[model samples]
Target: MTRQDISELYRGYIDCLNRQAWPELGRFVHQEAQYNGQRIGLSGYREMLENDFRAIPDLRFVIDLLIADPPHIAARLCFDCTPVGELFGLPVNGKRVSFTENVFYEIRDGRIAQVFSVIDKEAVRAQLGNDSP
Candidate 1:
């Protein structure tokens, strides 16, 4: 895929997530997808996303930055939502928080094959008034 094609594909994937189109995820994610080095297949990936939505009812993925290079993509995804309970082990407790996640993906056969993501936990901690990192 060209750079533009990859970018468009990623945008579509983000849109699918925003729409909670679980059934359509396979179009973007490969059957053998890996998340953070864990060999979680497409079904596990869907389950993880479902759990995320359940935890944060108003969860929305906003792309603050996106760059596509052939079979690779790097994105900064921003989120502004309230979690029903603790998030990333932090006591968000239904409080509204805004944070960003820096994620990278490797595309294989025009689908996401590998993912590495890091969320801004310090930002959440700061918002929660917790100095301890």
Candidate 2:
């Protein structure tokens, strides 16, 4: 996997996410892709995306920085969206929030096989206000 290829894959993946096109996500991930440390098959991944989009209609990923090496890439993605429904059990209706995450990905055969992400959960909770711990 070359850096350019990985970068392009990520770009398309982000595009799919932005468009909420869960089916297109299959083009970039393995059959057994994982998210949030959970082992999710491609169908499960699609379900998760659908659920997220249902909850956050305006969800998007802003690519602030991307550092790549063959077979791996680390990204600093700026996330922004408004909750149109409940998230983490918080009934925050249309509340806009912004946060960032550091995501490290490992690619195999030009597909993202694994990933690790660190989200600003505390900030998310703070944005959640009374729902926050």
- Whole-model lDDT values for every prediction: 0.96, 0.81
- The sequence of per-residue lDDT tens digits that candidate 2 reaches over residues 17-69 is 88877767779888888776888868887887788788887778889999989
Q: Estimate each model's TM-score.
A: 0.98, 0.86
Question: What's model 2's TM-score?
Answer: 0.86
Q: Which ten residues in a row have the lowest lDDT in candidate 1?
A: 124-133
Candidate 2 has which clashing residue pairs, if any? Answer: none
Candidate 2 Cα errors over 4 Å, as ranges = 128-132
On lDDT, the candidate that comes out on top is: 1
Per-residue lDDT for 1-133 in model 1, tens only?
Answer: 9999989999999999999999999999999999999999999999999999999999999999999988999999999999988998899999999999999999999999999999999999999999886
